[model samples]
Target: MWRRFTTVVGRVIPGAGSRCRKRGWVTPVTVVILGLSFLWTGTLADSNTPRQSVLRVLAWPGYADDDWVQAFEKRFHAKVEVTIVDSDEALWAQMHSAVPPPFDVLAANTAEIARYAQAGMLSPLDLTKIPNRRWQQPFFQRLSDIRGLVNAGHAYAIPFTWSSMGLIYDRKQFAVAPSSMRVMWDPRYRGKVLDFNSAQHNFSFAALALGYPDPFHLTPGQMRDVARELVNLRRNLLTYYTLPEEATALFVQHHAALMFGNYGTQQVEQLRKAGVDVGYVMPDEGALAWLDCWAITRNASNLDLAHQWLDYMQEPEIGKQLTQREGLANTMMPVPGGASDAGPKLVWLQLVENIGQREALWQRIESGDRLRTFPQ
Candidate 1:
């Protein structure tokens, strides 16, 4: 039995030609529907029934599709149960819901991989089994060079897809591309800027715009300063958005002039498809990027099968399909005119000093917390 949990939500943002509604604090709600279970039946005697290996997969929406899972099941004669998660908080909760963890494998960013590795929830990979990794670009081949991926001399995850959180501007709003992240804070664009509704990325990028040397690790004073800066950003935002589609809708409907491209190129593609003339640029302070990878659980029921799943994702054809379908940059090949290729600079995501602290403060800020409430 293959079960998939999916989230379906109505178009929350108004249409492009709709009247601009008064800007206020908007919290998007996600409705999760239990999709019908797919049962594969075959002719067999009850006594001769064969046990099919079950591979439980936890991934982001676009990472795992029905066609891909169906192909894997057909090739290996296994049952794949996929679970989709929209946020890191939900992913962490699902992983910890069971003793051995509910899923056999998961797709997470480098920072989340480090967090899982520290908790001993992930198993080290045997690169020998994933031979297709050789087809990856030179930058991805050297795993050790990337932080949060290799710990204690063991590789915990394999690179899959990545993009930098750069700046997205409406071409009609700006004669030249915005060169700095500070553009989002410009008073001229007040109530016309869109920012991702993420605690970690918001704090990290705020630090970058403030000329902080290290974004992941911040001093107590630095944290307070970043929080205050975010308060200023809140005043300029039309509203915070959670998904790329939502951001696109808000951008078009509100006639937004600028946005922090949290989804990076993926958001850019979505906006373009929506008939918006948008240009993406990496700010001078550098963009915070995320590299999503596949990692096997520490207590995987089928170790070989989990490894095969990782290898399957690395196949050149599979990578191409993912890129074409999702507008994501796959590791197997170079992205044509991609931001990561010969860009300003990319600060690969790393484990932050204190995720708990960031989240608590972000909650307050996003809820319309006043500037005086923040630390000095």
Candidate 2:
């Protein structure tokens, strides 16, 4: 059951930050939870303190894998209920709306956190209850050092996995596929290209191509320039798939020449098992970096159990399982003694939070107005 759950949550793979843009989806009341059992049917909490058996979590497909819930319940002696978010927008709507804090914790990326904190939807860290907080990493330390980090100037969330966006491709097809973002738009491979699942990714990739240092810092003119280019690519695109696994599948089935994927090497291997040939590369300009964290939601009924669950996950053994099951990298620990480097890119992406530019760029891309890359 847990493996089945992982399979679903694994789809989100990696993307987004702390607060997801709410413009995308109009959330439904009945959140579809994976890895669900009788775990959340009843309330199991200690009267003296907050003891919760059922935990409501809004996560992408595989974040609530049954294995995780079963392990957590067995170790902490509690039940957890998970809701699989349909899209990034939907998960964030749950965070900002008048909706109650349905889940005890969120396995969301860091970029999305700032939005949640600003909306007064998220709470500060109750670090005392969690043991993982004690095993902090230096990389995380530097991130927190940045002045005025979202949640009340304190990190309410704990970093779990870390990755940057890079290219994963097929070796058999491109004996010499360059890491440059231009390859996706190259006319020689025109209709064979597939792009990243998000607008930020789309525009940022173009920004890099246009020689911009930061995608988020683009001026209006630069944005328009990139938008036109995106629109053109959309026209030539085979399909715009959001799932990491799906991106990999495009290559496995020979439906696409290249895809915008940063991690999930397991898919590459799986494709190989089925006789698909592929490889991954990070372009010279670079890719985006992402951090997935575990945070407690305000009003979460089983806060204490959630903290315990976090502690259990921080344990190397459990963290290892998470990394193995999902292709994303974790911040809790360094890559084990011997691990492959087929993760995402090395450069941190300039995340776009501005709604106006974001929408315009995506619209232009979808409209096929200016994109033209495959220099013939």
Candidate 3:
């Protein structure tokens, strides 16, 4: 029998300083000068027509695979349609548009769950309807206890998958494993590193590696420092990547020595399956861990059916399938074989002070702009 899911509890408190502040961390003048650009305008394919008796899902790549979806549809006697997303910004745009949201159920991280809950785009889950949650680890059952799963006495999301963003390196390059995050910036790895293209995560990781006290809340001076740090990283990087598959192809073709693992072990699995000799490590600076959950939309046409999907996913067999096929850690059961969740210290994601500012700064960095280009 498989062990119970790991009950690692590190939920941050609400109304804490770490939550995104109402006033921007930096001066409004500074944000205005940066001229933030909101570029996520991609539309879902065939979202116009409403499917009859279908359970529409919007989730990340592996969450709604054909194998498990077919299983769920067969079990519930309902047709399943999925829309995949690469980022939280994209997920927000989809649900925010349709009142009875275009999709009934979707997966999102804690920070995003908080945002959607605040926007009133998500629905409170009826735990009584999801009895399978009894099989979930205690940490997950106490949804209100988690940092972002509950708001104003309502359960907004169900913890489903969890993993840490760590370093993935080429094993052939180093017989002994490296222990520090600095390897990504080492001079020896010049033009051999692949970095994620996201503004929020890159800035946070840079802050972590630089020993910043709080990676999520950077002062203007710290922001400038992180910006310069990323510019240096850009000089050494072969290219920045977004999707896991894209990273895999780049790693193989470019012979990348180091990469910031965004999809966590999922990326590691993909690379290994492609026959690449690579190793993953959580550096001394610690790794950022993201917990993604399944949530219902406020306008879901089939509320009961949506709850069934969440309940079914929490099953041991389905959770096992998630790990074996997608290379993702499932919250419904312990990591197979009594593996410990202990590793690099796990930094639970929190609301940033100013995501717009980070996005603006990131656009500049990606465009190859010098740090001096933006006004101080």
Candidate 4:
């Protein structure tokens, strides 16, 4: 919910590396030889030769499409290599697989952006280069208002798309929309509920339902309590789903009455297209929302091109196309009946206190670990 490109070896300057290690500095004779090699190998090519810049993009499935990428390439006279990632774990693995990240730019949620920024994997953006950001809504334009985009007085990400994880209930089954997250736990919906198979969100939402002050940063006791709550939810769940398409199929097949809309409105739109009359709502405990943004890598090959790509995404028409095609809300415009619609509070995602702990415990809970084994 995310490219193949030939690796281009960077040209090494004669004394660039040696400058840091003076003891192994290149000799004058060696520098002269290297200079000639550059000329002989055509490293300094003719000025008239047309050169196309390559920009590798790592993004979610709907974020980078063939047609949209083609348009960006044509406009900038560059080549875009696209790679799609379906989950956060995979995205992190790919980003760290290489010494200098393989991609020039990537799209990631705010929490991931914070993690990458903290790890020094991302480059601070030059806002001046991205003129199109002015088109973004006020809520998005204020980088400080949104956590995880700025660090140490520098902004590292530009908002792209966002949505909330809410509840989706079968319209025919319920006369009115559910008002709280507790509805999923009601015995009436037991064996008829579908939940997304995600450790982080499951724990966060469970904390929310239990009325934790900060869902992202739970104490040791709170984590144990939340884990127990998830164990209870497991009993109510018809089954866990990894993808929206899979959830849609399970919902229709099992005649499921409720589902944790992990993909938010995107799932709603999909279910509707499949002829399912579903109603979505953010429970009284507030829904967890994600704001995905574009950020250039610290080792970006071409900063100008990367900035151009970010600016291009912020363009009104491109944003409109993204919303219309993917059913996601773009920062450039407000989408009616979108996650920001009236009545439901949205809790923007934040870097959690301990992701490893959440994943480990969630694995045990999801694998049928006994509730009695959990700490009281």
lDDT top scorer: 1
List the lowest-lDDT window of 10 residues for candidate 1. Answer: 28-37
Distance from true position, residue 175, model 4, in Å? 2.5
Q: Write the per-residue lDDT of candidate 4 for residues 1-376, one digit (tens) a residue.
A: 0132223122223223432222221111111000000113335657897977888888876787767887887799887777665567657877987888788999999999999999999999999999998998877888876789999999999999988889999999999999899998999887899887678889999899999979999999999899999888766777776556657777887789999988898888888888999999988999988889999999999999999999998999888988787678888666334434323488878899999999899778767778899889
Q: How many backbone clashes does candidate 2 have?
A: 37
In candidate 1, stretches whose alpha carbon ends up further than 4 angstroms from where it belongs are: 1-23, 30-48, 335-344
Model 2 TM-score (2 dp): 0.76
- Model 4 lowest lDDT segment of ten: 30-39
Kindly list the per-residue Cα lDDT of model 1 for residues 1-376, writing each as its tens digit: 4444444433344453333233374555432222222554555447767888989888876787888888898999988887776667667878998897978899999899999999999999998999988889877878887777888999999989988889999999998888999988899898899888778889999999999999999999999999999999987888877667778888987789999987888888889999999999889999888889999999899999999999999988888887787678899666444434335488878889999999999988877778887778
RMSD of each candidate relative to the true structure: 3.7, 7.5, 12.0, 13.7
Model 2: per-residue Cα lDDT at residue 328: 54
Which residue runs does candidate 4 get wrong by more than 4 Å? 1-51, 334-344
Error of 1 at 175 (Å): 2.3
Local accuracy of candidate 2 as per-residue lDDT tens digits, 139-159: 553446422234445666776
Q: lDDT (CA) for every model shown?
A: 0.82, 0.59, 0.76, 0.79
Off by over 4 Å in 2: 1-52, 96-98, 134-136, 141-143, 146-152, 262-275, 332-345, 349-353, 360-364, 367-376
Q: Which candidate's TM-score is highest?
A: 1
TM-score of structure candidate 3: 0.82
